[model samples]
Every structure is written in C-alpha cells, then in structure tokens.
Target: MEDSPRSQELLSLEAIYPDAELDITSYSGTITISIHSADPVGISFAAVPNTQPLYDSINYLPPLKFFFQLPETYPDTPPTVALLSLWLPEATLTALHASLLLIWDDFRDMVVFLMVDHLQEQAFVLFGLDPPIALTEVQFEFFVSYNREQLQEEFDTQSFTCEICQQYKKGKSCLRIELCRHIFCKACLLEYFSTCITAGDIEKVHCPDYECTKRVAEERKRMADPKTFITSGTSTRDMILRVVFTPPLSLDFLSFLPPEIVTRFQTLFTRDQYEFFKSNFPNRAVNCPVEACGHGIIRDDVNDDLVVCPKCRYAFCIHCTNSWHGKSMCRLAVRLDIPEDVLEQYLSYPELSKDRRDLEDYYGKFKLRRAADAWHMDVLFKEMMANELMTACPSCGVVSAKMDGCNKMTCHLCKTPFCYLCGEFLDRARPYDHFNDPVSECYRRLFEGMLGTEEELMRPIAPGFAL
Candidate 1:
C-alpha cells in the first residue's frame, strides 16, 4: 500500500528518534520519550531550596511521555501535541501545548523533529514550574503556580554525591543546612556531632564552614572577647555562607540519632536554655556549683538572696554569686578575665601577642587599689538590684536603669528591648500594657521617676493593634 503523508512523516520521526515507540492507530500515533536527553535550555527547580542541587546526576529523572496527533494535511500543518504527565497541573500541560504551537506556527510546515527537540529541551521550563507569578483571577493559573512547588519535592528524592566524605547518598540520608545548604551525609554528620558533643563543644555545634574554622587562629588574635565577637574582621559573611547557630536538623529529626547521642545533645541544649533563663530571670532558678549536685534551686521570692542547694545542701549567696558569709561581708566581684587564647580566637588574629609585664607595670602604678571588701560591697549592690530594682538583658547583660520611660527598654548596644523588671523582651508593639495589668510582675511601676510624664506612662494600648 502506498504510504499516506502522515505515515511517511511518522516514519521520518521514528528514524530520528529510534527509542520513541509509536502506537499507530487508525486515527493517530503516540511517540514516547522515556529517557534522559540533554536539555541545557531548561531550568531545573524554581527557587533553589534549602538543599543542594543533586550534582552530576542523570540516572533518576522521570521520563517524558507525550502524544502527537497528525492532521490530514501532513506536511502543510503542525501536529496537535498533548503531554501525559498526569501529576502536572492542566495549565502546565496547556501552557506547554501553547509553547509547542508557537514553534509549530514559526514553521507552519513539516516541523515534527523541530517540535520534538523543543519539547525535549524546553518542556521543564515551559511547564509553569518557575516560581509562580501570581495571577489571582484565573483559578487554573493560580493552581498551576501552587502545584509547581511540588516539583522540588520530587527532585529531592533522587540521589546525589555528598560533598563531605565524597560519597553518593540518597537524598533522604543527607542533611542540608538551611542558609548554607551544604549537603552532609548521615554517617559523617552523626560522627562529627558525636565527637563535638562528647567534648562539650555545645555552642560550637554549627555548619562546618571550613573558612571560619581555618580562620579561628587569626580570629583569636584580633579580639579580646571570643563570646561577644559578632562580625569577623577577616572571614566575611560570604566565606562562612551563613554564620548562625541554628542546627541543620530540627528536633523532629533527632530520632535519626541514637538515644545516647540524643541524651548528650539534650544535656547541652537544656543547659543553654537554663543559662538563658538564669541571665534573664536571676532570682527564678539559681544554678548550684557543687559538683554532681545536678540541680537548680527555685527562688520563689525576689528578696531571697541566699540559695540552699536542695540536693547538695550547699548554701550560696545570690549577690556575691559565691559561698555564703553570714555576718562577714562577701568579697568583691571582679570582671571575668578573658584568657589570651580566647582573646586571640575572638580577634581572628592568632599571631598577636602583648608584653604582659610591661602592661602590668603600666597599669599597676596608675591604678590605686580599693579596699579588698569591694566584692563584698558589690554583693550588697547585687542583692538590692535583684530583689527590688532591675533585670539584665540576656544578650548584652546590660542592667536595667529605667527611671521614667515605659517599662519596655531597649539595650543601646544590642537594640533588644527588654522589661526592666522581668528582663524579658517586650512585644515591640504593646510594650506599655505589660505593666498596666495588676497580675504583671512590674505592674504600676512604669514611671520609675526618670523621664516620661504621667500621661505617656499611663497611655493605654488601643484595641486590635499595638503601636
């Protein structure tokens, strides 16, 4: 039988795409491309998520199955295109069809191979998979955009080589830090975290950005205070990708770790939370220093300066933060002396050195020593501050000295506004209301007789909104 033009065109297509299997029915034929092909033109996932792109991977992308129906006027008109990826929103399929049509219209004749290559190369991008531009009126457009995000989830399930340990791993077995998005396999991360936790490097549990790690020596030499150093002079933010304290994995994923590891992690995490509370709420729970006593004594009253460790039966004074001296004065409190190593580490300038004897000689003669009872006086001062007057900012340790402004006060250095009485951060909006209520800890004490007038201090928060 003499071949129809459509059949002849189908034969040409089959010749070009040998793997494309054709289902030749009386009405139409469908050619399926069920394998990977080079599509440098196509965009992958829309917004690169908090995960690395599966690198040097080609074995796992799903196949592209499509249908093409020929018109009676074979070489004179374009074939009708239909995609069969059912999970794709209809608008995506429709948008794809429209894109193909544009290519078909450009030729308007015998463009089968051209159309197929376009489909292979551009289908991923044209499928409405980019971050959606909002189009609210048309529900189909909105859904197509909403559903496009699912493509990332599908892409994540594939396997990729973890940069650390240089091993291929399934996506599920890898953890990606949010801001940095560095991929670390399960075994490598668990091992590293185990070693760090065992050594009590709790606060240092962070993304192992090597630049920051390598610069630790230099960072040390440049700063005196390691704990308070915010911006590194040498290692800029980009070198670290993200300089933050958030762990790569959430508490929900803690089950992936062994129970022993979990316990160790919880020990450090609990200590951090306790320290946070202690700094902000000094009289709430006092940490006892006796080794293995392992308990916090609750301070029910603001005036309670003496803490008796319930477990160890060791008594300590809150003001001096030391062993109790009943009638004898508590010794003076000295500023915490930062060690040289810690200073160098904070400065990121490990090579720096100072002439200690020269500095000692210079400072020693200029400064006259006060009475040895200075710490004793500080103890009494602390007792009054904790019991009657103020709280300190947890971040900067700035003491509350509000005389007149609203109960909410912002730390000048850290800019963290906290309550003078509770030392808790005030809601940025309705700060004044915190003291107005009768049940509040600092109630009716908004005006500490320093700055604001009676009306400003007593101004009530408006309904539904805070200023």
Candidate 2:
C-alpha cells in the first residue's frame, strides 16, 4: 500500500532527466524501469564502407535504450540491471553492466543519478565516437515518426515570431525548412511560394536569412584579431580561428518549402535546362519576349524584324522585348503585377529585397525565359521521332533512319542496342533472339517481311540481311 524507496527514486528521475524518456511498471512486488536515451548513434567500420546519405537521414539508428529491474531492496541490495540495443558489442555491454555495479557500491544509498551519468559519459566510447555529433537525417526520420504527436504538442507550447508575417504563431502552425532553419507561419510561406511559382519565377527561392548574411561582414570585422607569433627560434603560426556561429537557418534546407512549391520548381528547372542550351547553341536561336513562354525563333534574313513567340502566341519587335511597334522605336516598359498584400509583406524584408520594389521575381523571369526556350527546342527534336519517320533510340534519343533492314538496330552514338519496331532497349548479347524467341512479342517475325515473301526463314541467318 505504501510506496517503496526504489519507486520514489524512479519518480525523482523524471525531474533529473527532463529530455530523457522513461517507462515504469510494477508487477507483483518487483518494479521494472525502462530508460530511452535522448541521443542516437551510427558506427562506421574499416572493411564495410559507410554508404552515401548517412548524413541528414531521417532514418537512422534508434535511441540507445535499456531496462533495469530494481529489487525490493535496490541501492541497499545491489539490484540487477540489463542492457538492450544489439548495436553495442556484447563484451562492451558486459563490462558496462559490471562497472555500473561498482559505481552503485560507492554510494550505496543514492546511485541512479551517478549510474545514468556514467552511462552518458561512456556512450561515445561504446559507440566509437569521441564527442557525439547530433544525429543527422539517417536516424531522425524514425524518431520523428515515432514521436510526431508528442513533438507537435511540445512545439505547439512554444511560440515563434514568424519572419514573414511578423506575427507570433504556435509551433504546430509554424514551420522550419529542411536545410535552412528559417522559421515562418505555414500561411505566409505557402501563399508566398504559390504566387512566385504561378508567375514562373523560381530563382527567387531563398531561406530569407538576409539579416544573418549582412551580419557576417560585421562579425568578420569584430573577429579580426592582431596576427601574433611566439617563436622559440623562428616558428610559423596557423590562422587564429574564432567561433563562427552558423545561422539558425541554413540555405541548404529546402525541406521547409511547401511540397507543391518544390514539385513546381523541379518541373521549371528541367524546362530551363533545355532552354539555356538551345539559345547558347551555335544556331543562335532568338528568344521570345515573354518570360514564361521563351520560344525560340529562326530569322531568315537581316530584314526579319517581325518575330513571334510560337509557344506564348505573342508577336514582338526583334530588337526590343516589347509589342511589335512597326519599326518606330518601341517605348513602353515592362510592368510587374503583384498583389498588394504580398507587396506589403516584402516591404519589411529590405534585406531580401533591395531596390527591386516592383517585382520579387526579376531573378526568376530571366531563368524562366531560358528554361522555356530549352524545353521548346527539346520538344521540337522529340516531335520528329513521334511522327514515326525516324526511330529515336530509347537510351540515347538519337534519331535513326531505317533505310531497309529487320527490326533489330543499334545506336551509333551511345552504342545501345534496341528494337527498331517496338522502340524498346535490347540486350546486346542476345539481340536477335527478341524476334525469333517463342516468348517474345516479336516472335517468328524475323525476316518475315525483309525478303518481301511473308516468310520467316527459320533459326540461322536470313540470306541477305546482317545480324
């Protein structure tokens, strides 16, 4: 009926290790306590190389958890303790367990706190690390998944002043992006990115850590210590390294970006890569005035002033990015049509926005035009093959004209073997079997129409055709 001394100590542990998680239960007269380590670890071996993406993995090793069975008489009686987590070596665990008992004997009455501290200090040695680095993405995902609800509750209790809206929002409503630690309310980030994407401007994407960037120069000035030397005879000294605190938000973390924004940006990036190559090519393709529809046009002669963006359906003057003004020196300037609310929000962010007040998408428009041009050119090249006049190799995209031959063919550029008729990549070693094999869709079709006799010459080579 009355609480035991071991039970009272277990409750006191909750206060000692605030970050640590614990599970306690009583069965009959015995008490079992489970301790979950706040930290996780990963080991690299000499023979087995650590694979890529071990860094910043959301999935990695689980917490270094273990259980202890406290007898009716624990500190006074030297109770038994057990180790969990197979990641640790058996011998190391045994040694650690023995050491824990030795530690208990030092303070026979008060021992749990000392035992936990001992475990924490020796954790790195057991895991083969000196000072432990925070667990990266490798194991973060599993922990996050297992503790999502609890994490959200904890975050919701804290309040952050959103950088964009300048309004204090609870943790559940606010978001911190993947690489960059820039924090913002979900409403502001989603709307801001959506507007930019719709206008086809992706280059404007950033962590909004403008103040931190400006502070770097000031910080460098403060960090400039006098160059010093202490020589026994004549000794050289390395540069004095001062602590350079990383900005809370990293530019690298885009996981903070809305999923829809990331998806749209990827689509635009691909299109831009094609456009950039097309205009830069030797043909000197002319670009359309429209940023989103950067169609490329080929001018026939010097008097070709009338240029049309075939993709955007806009006709414009060749010399300037304006409407076709009939050679009279066009004079209207481009205007950026942005929403009032969005413009007001950007006004507070002078660090992010310099003299560019009319549009936040100036950088993005240039990128979009280049991408549009490239996408258009690639589309044209692909259309030729789509018409069936020429066969495009599935692997290399090289258009080949099959003058007169069987379906089996190989690309001259990449040396990729493929089926000419079906347009499927073929095995180089057993290329001919695709047509003659009974299981193949092109079965019994080899030399079926090559000789114009509607007869497939059995196995072996068909007289006139090459293998």
Candidate 3:
C-alpha cells in the first residue's frame, strides 16, 4: 500500500526501525497504531521490548495515556510507544535493551506478530513499565485487570447525573480534573455550574474549591460536554433568567450566556416589555407640561441633555415623565405593555410557525430537542422584535419590515436591499451580500471606528464594490 501521512511521518523520524511496517488509525480523537517487525536492532524493538516482566509492567498502567508508534518500514527501524504522564525507571530501560541483544536473532522479524492484536492494550502493556521484575501468573493477571479498570475509571469521569439540571446520580459521582489530582463529587460541580448559568456568570464559574489551580481547565471540560446538566426537579430556567434581567446587565457580561438562554429570555419578556419600553422610551421624550408643546418630551436627540422633541419641541425631564427641565430625579421607568392589536400587527401566526420551525431545526441539529418547545419559541420571537425597534435603513431612510417567505428586500426610495434587523443595504447579486452589504459597512464605520484606530472605515467597502 502507498504510504499514508502517518506512514510518512514515521519514515521521516530517524529513530524508527529500518524496513518496519507501519499502520495508523484513530480512536476518540487520539491516533495510535500497530506495527510488526522482526529485527531487535530495529526502532520498534528498541522502543518496546517483549520480555515477560515488561508485559507485567505494561499491563499495570492506566489506559488513558497508552499509545503505540509504528514504523513505515520493517526490521531496519524500531517503533516508539508513548504513555502520557507516565515514567519508567532507567534500570528497567537498561535491562530491556540488554534483553533485546540476547533475543535479537529469534525475535528479529517475529516482533511484529506480537503486536497483531489489541494495539492500545499492547501499548499499555509495553510502554508503561517501571523497571519490570519477574511476576507470578496471578500477579500478571492482576496487572492486566488493573489496566482494564483504569480505562473504566476514565470513562466514568465523563458520565454524570441529570444533564439538564447538572445533577449527579448517587453512584455516578466522578469529577476529575486531569491537571490537578483533586477530585470532587459530580453532583457538587453540577450545582455550581447551574448557579453560574442562572446568574449569567458562566465566565466566573471556575472550580468551587479555592485551592484548585486547575479551575479554568476543569470549567472548559464541563462546558464541552453538552449532555452534562441537571434534568430533574424545577426547571432552573427561571432562576437563570432572574440572574440576567433583575440586575441591569451590561452588554459585555451578557454575551457569555449560551444562545439558548438568550433565546428563551427573549421569548418570555419581549411582547409586554417591548411595548411598554417603546411608549415610555421613545426617541421623543414622554409627555411634558411645557407651555409651547405640552404633549412632547424630547428623548435622546442630544447626548446627556433633556431637549425638545423635533415634532413638538417640548422640553421634559430625561429621567421621569415631568416638565422639570433643570431638576433631576424625574426619570420614569419606560412604560411597556403589549398592545391589543400587536399579536396581529407585528407577527402573524404564520410567522410564528416559521420561527417555531427554525427553533426546532436548530435544537434537533444540536441534540437539544427537549428545549424546542412552543413556549421557548414564543419567548424567542418576542425578544427579537423587542430588540429590533426603531431599526431603519440609513441610505434609503426606509423603515424595514420582516415578513415570512422573504429574506430579500428592496427599498422604494434608494432601491437599497438590507437586513430588516440592522437596516444595512445588502446587494443581492454578490455572494458576500449577506455580510458585506452597505448596512453592515455603515454600522461598522460608526461603532468600530470609535473603538479602533484612525485607519478603519465603517464597512471597509471598496470603491468598485456592489451597492
């Protein structure tokens, strides 16, 4: 067979046995191999010695780190084996090398046949020696059993209790940090993770134990296993929401929440909260008792100043719904209520259905089918609409609208096509239109410019780029 990438890698290495055969395969994201050869002078022979004592030592090793290195050729080169985080005594190495010379003639080509089965186990048996001494048959069996048991322990660390609620079962408690020798009950860590998620503080969810130096690493492991969560009892969803909203969350801190949390929160609070906020927090201020325009209160035309509304030119308190132009503490909560006609006006049943379909599709793909419920969809849609209020196309000055069965849209005034959410013009013909459109360019220039250096533009649009 033609040499594979792994074979090539082995051939390039100077330590590999000359003329040794090489085979490569992968398991659980880790690569390993089986190599066969007959030469004791070969690289494989030098790497692994097949004495009885060596087998006893290898059979006693933990399975997590067992791996075999194979040669691309045979007899001429020796293969290497690696057992991560494992070490052997120098005397053992010396004795194995000496033993190889004595058996060099009988075992030269036959060494490859020794590795004809259980490559990982072979590696564990050969690579994890600590100066092997002779062992009785019962002792040899005990060491083999130990290797098997070690692999089981590694697997148990991954298996947890209730994945949704982050709970651990009674017998399944095995929280291990690879970096630290410290171990914890899986149940404790699950509870800790839930607390972090609910508080909108996943960024801060390190190991609960203050002395654990491997907190960051442990947290990353926990996050990667999506199936690890608490499933039974009261859904912790509401508690998580309370942590996000009850305190006025900064934009920076809120970004850490999984997209699911944000989606759910949006669905739950959008309709009533959005309408109330719009009425009270309009670009124009709340109603003021100013003599010139009692009905108008300018909102945020000028930064940090309570100014007159453009339409009515009435000065009002920026804080409360009062006409106190200079006095402070008049700021009022943005009034928000779902309009009676809002159900029909903003979103039709058909649009909701499409949203539901999208959510279902997303959850199914991600294996989060339990979260793809109607109530969750409802909350997500409402939140989306709430966030998109006052979005308008800067180029055409056209207010954007979203309807089902349509993603492409054209403005009447400027003929600019853009996303409904951000009002950036999307040129329909180009492949990059979705991302590199005019609307996106404008937004980038405005916000990113302020945060970046002098060289940046809003959208980085080239002169010849499509509109």
- Can you give the TM-score per candidate against the true fold? 0.36, 0.40, 0.19
Candidate ranking under TM-score, highest first, comes to 2, 1, 3
**Candidate 3 C-alpha lDDT tens digits along 26-89:** 2111232321112111011122346423342332342223234545544444444443322334
Top lDDT model: 1
* lDDT measured at residue 295 in model 1 versus the true structure, 0 to 100: 79
Off by over 4 Å in 1: 1-22, 25-66, 71-73, 76-78, 83-109, 118-132, 135-178, 181-185, 197-201, 212-248, 251-271, 274-277, 280-467
* Residues forming the 10-long window of minimal summed lDDT in candidate 2: 235-244
* Prediction-by-prediction clash tally: 22, 21, 58
In order of lDDT, best first, we have: 1, 2, 3
- The C-alpha RMSD of each candidate to the native structure, in angstroms, is 23.0, 27.5, 29.5
Cα error of candidate 3 at position 419, Å: 99
lDDT over C-alpha atoms for residue 29 of model 1 = 54
Candidate 1's residue-wise lDDT over 174-242, tens digit each? Answer: 876644667777788788877887888765555666764555435433322213222335432222222
lDDT against the true structure, per candidate, is: 0.56, 0.55, 0.41
